[model samples]
Target chain A: MELILSIAIGTLTASGVWLLLRPRTFQVIIGLSLLSYAVNLFIFGMGRLRMDAAPILEGAGSDPANYADPVPQALVLTAIVIGFAMTALFLVVLLAARGLTGTDHVDGRER
Target chain B: MGALFDHLIAVPILLPLLAGALMVIVDDRRRPFKIAVNLVSTLTLLIVAITLLMIAGGMTASGDPARTSVYLLGNWPAPFAITLVLDRLSALMLVLTSVLAVAALIFSLARWHRAGPHFHTLFQFLLVGINGAFLTGDLFNLFVFFEVMLAASYGLVLHGSGTARVRAGLHYIAINLSASLLFLIGVALIYGVTGTLNMADLAARVGDASAENRVILEAGAAILGIAFLVKSGMWPLGFWLPTAYTAAAAPVAAIFAIMSKVGVYVVLRLSLLVFGPEAGDSAGFGAHWILVGGMVTIGFGMIGVLASQGLSRIAGYSVLVSSGTLLAVIGYGTAPVISGALYYLVSSTLTISAFFLLIELVERARDAGADVLAVTMEAFGEDEAEDAEEEVGVTIPFTLAVLGASFAGIALLLAGLPPLSGFLAKFAMIHGMFNPTGLGDGLPIGAGTWVLVALLIVSGLAALIAMTRSGISIFWASIERTVPSVRVIEVLPVLGLLGLCLAMTLQGGAVIRYMDETAASLSEPAGYIESVLTAERVARAPSGTPDPAQGADEETEVAP
Candidate 1:
């Protein structure tokens, strides 16, 4: 499970960096989204690949280690939501920029 | 402090948040209503900031220590809940933000508010983010507040949208978004290794990390440093700053003067706290990197300042210089230098903000056609109309006089000329660096310190040259121009900011003493960590050991 998750994050990050370096605004936006996905997955993985364990305490005497860590899960959820808002905001700005500049280049002009 | 006052720690973050949301609900057509709300909220924020400063300065009813105050949300114990820590440093930053925000908002009232929709709401949200970033005791919350700040900044940057603004804003957003991703990854990696996000908790755990985990932890910290350095306008990561700041509206750019400092503040807080002398083998893990990067940043900033064409770009490069000085001085990691840098921080921020606001008003009077021609000539190295008829020299007009005076003041402040806070701040830093008393670490003067000193002086000279050249071209050389119809409201904010800088110079003694104390407190992170981890518990239960809330598995709970 850890191997698979690490590989997924690495792949996502690699693609994100490639796209981010591209000149087109759309490529950068997609890159940001992909990078955010990798970040979110990385955050989720911070909980150490928990499975089949409830985050909540079963009882007062229950061993805390037996339960999954809930903090990173909460953090990742927030990151996901923020990432969504970030992508949406970027898309709007890029579109507006394209309309105004009459080009889709990141620098708003042709090379 | 009483429980009533305990909540005050959170007010700086909450008040602006609620006000921002409420302002969003108000109809944008009612200009008077929006103005009124903004005024009242900003005024209230000012009062709250003063109150917090006073409290942190040791005016608490319970006679609690002045250095650290912790307010745990929902009355939860420290490690488990979101906490707002108010020490002298945080309170000072809060006051600075309020001062800047009030001035910028008032300046915007002159004309800028009409340029965009929900300007007031975005402004308030920006404050919420900045204040929250200052107060947050944990890394995750810092990230969240950073995002909040950046989100509002995106809207604010595009407020008075133009081609230049859109282009600059696009770069700003893209760079900041990438930085934010790195911030998240850094946080995740740190959390994975240290198993805690609370800064105080992390400080405690970081020192105890096994050798295997140390590499991962340092990697995380390095990445985190990169994100912060980018935001702080360090060289190589800061080429976007000059364009973006020049393109932003006057008020937006003014408030943003503090935005980069937020990065500086975080770097100082985290570096000294987590990786300070107490971190054993990891002690001073990234200090040399910071010093080298900072000096490089200063060198680049000086060159950029000298190379820039306009007053706005000059102001932007000045930001880089200021950040570089602070970053490098911080790398020295001495209490006295930091205290001096803290003083410098306030002085430079106010000066640059004043300069940014003053630039627009100064440019307003110039002939638009002449302005474009001058820019084109500057860009293409072409001298045109050199043989044209000469004009008679005359007394500087009312508008030019005001601009000239303000420009001189900004130059004096930026260039660290005598009889101003900037001079005093830089002098204090140099004095602290060479303090014969050697009370702090007493580390012998190194080549790095000498390099920093040289860069500081050179950067000041660069600013002087840049400001003089631009100031001459804008006010003296340009011939065909109508006197800018200056408004009292517009001029007042610039004067107010500059006046504040002057006052800081006048009252340098008291302010430096306070900053010295703040720096002393910051150097000793034990008090901060202890106060944060135990403040709530101590309040609820006097006995320290075996509190029912903290189970035997403190390690387990703190870790995975």
Candidate 2:
């Protein structure tokens, strides 16, 4: 399971980076979104691949090691939300740039 | 009062946040009320900053190295909830931010506040993020505050609607967004290995990690440092800075000066706190790279300065030079150089900010068509009768005289000329570099140190040439110039900032003493670790259980 997850993350990140190097702003935005997803998954996997384990403890006395680590889950959740907001912001700015420059190239012109 | 003092560390982050939220709801048409709110909150921030500085100073003066004020949010214990720790370093950054924010806020009052819908709200939010970044003692919270700072900055950078600003803002946002993703990855890697994200706890754990874990930790730190280096405007990664900063409106650019230093501040804080001498095998992981990168950044910035045609771009590159000097000096990791770097940091930030603000006022009256043509001509090394007719004026206008004098002050300060704090700061660094005490030696300086010293002096000279060329072009070269109708509001902020720089020059002794103490405290992380880790340790002692959830909502009372 760990190996499969690692490979998946690697693939996502590699493709995202490749797309990020594209010239078009739309491709760059998609690339950033892909990269963010990979990062979110990576953060989620930091808790060491829990199987059927609870993130929340029912009682005050439950051992922490018995449950899935909640911190990474929280962190990944925050990352996902922030990533969404950032994507929205980037899309708006890209549209504005496209409107003003009459091109969608990241550098504002097609070479 | 005692309770207020106990909670004072949280106020810097909270005050701006609350005021910003309030400003969002206040009708934009209520301009006076919005202005009143911004003024009151910023002034209050200044007061709180002065108080925090005094508290930090008193703590340092009491000779107790472990006397840091750690505030736990949501009534949680250390390593469990978010903690805000105020040591000498953080307190100093808070004061610096407040001071710069006050100046920028006043300068913006001239016309910039009316530019957009949520200008005041965004400014306050920017402060919230900056203060929070400085004070947060946890890595994830640092990232959160970093996002806050970046988000607010994106808004401010695009505050005024212009084609140049939007284009540059897109690049700025893209670069920073990628950097933020790297920051997340780095944090995740570190958290995966150590099972902790509290900075103090991480510092403790990093020393005891297994070899494999240590390797991962170092990789994470390197990646994290890249994120900061991008923000710090280190040579290659900071190509977007000149364009973005030059294109932004004046007040935003001035406040953005401190924005780059936020990266420097993080690098200094984390490098020392988490990976300092006490980190065993990882004592000085990236010091050499920082030195090399900083030197190259200085070289790049110098070239950029000399090649820059516009005064705004020159000021932008000067920011890069300032970052390079601080980073390079910091890379040395010596107490004396660090102290001097701290002094240089304060003086240069103030001067560069004043210079950015002054550029607009000085260049406002020049004919844009002729100015651009002249710049293009100068760019091609043509120095003939392009504007020779207008250069025959004898009497300088009053506003022109004030501007010329201010320009001269800025040039002297940026170039590190004699009789100013800039010169003093650079001299102290060189002196400390050559004569670092306790090195047991014939000569303590190395080849790398010599290279840094040479770069420092050469960069100063480069700044001198660039400033002289640009100053002549703007003030002296032009003939058909209308005397810029400067307002008192705008002129006062520049004078106030310059006066502060002069004051730093006059009181170099006391300021250097403070910086020396701050640097000394920074060099030893044991005190920071002990203070933070021990804060909530005692509160959980009576329970005698290592239960992570015990103090989830308990306000662990700090001992006075």
Candidate 2 on B1-560: residue-level lDDT in tens? 26668788999999999999999999887878989999999999999998888787774344533357888776566887889999878888898899889988998876566656688999999999999999999999999999999999999998765667788999999999999999999999999999999999999888888899899999999999999999999988999999999988788999999999999999998888888987889898898888889999999999999999889999999999999999888888899899999999999999989998898788667665335324433433232364344334333348888889999999999999988888998998987798788444567457898899999999999999999998888788868867876677777788888998899999999999989988998999898898888776324445556444444323232211
The regions of model 2 sitting more than 4 angstroms off are B59-66, B369-397, B438-444, B536-560
Give the backbone clash total of model 1: 0
C-alpha DockQ for predicted model 1: 0.60
> RMSD to the native, candidate 1?
7.1
Clashing pairs in 2: B390-B479
DockQ numbers for every candidate? 0.60, 0.61
Writing each residue's lDDT as its tens digit, candidate 1 over B66-115 gives 75888877666897768899989989999999999988998888667766
Clash-forming residue pairs, model 1:
none
The most accurate candidate by lDDT is 1
Q: Residue B509 in candidate 2 has what lDDT?
A: 93
Q: Residue B178 of model 1: what lDDT?
A: 96
After aligning candidate 2 to the native by TM-score, how far in Å is the CA of B9 from where it should be? 0.8
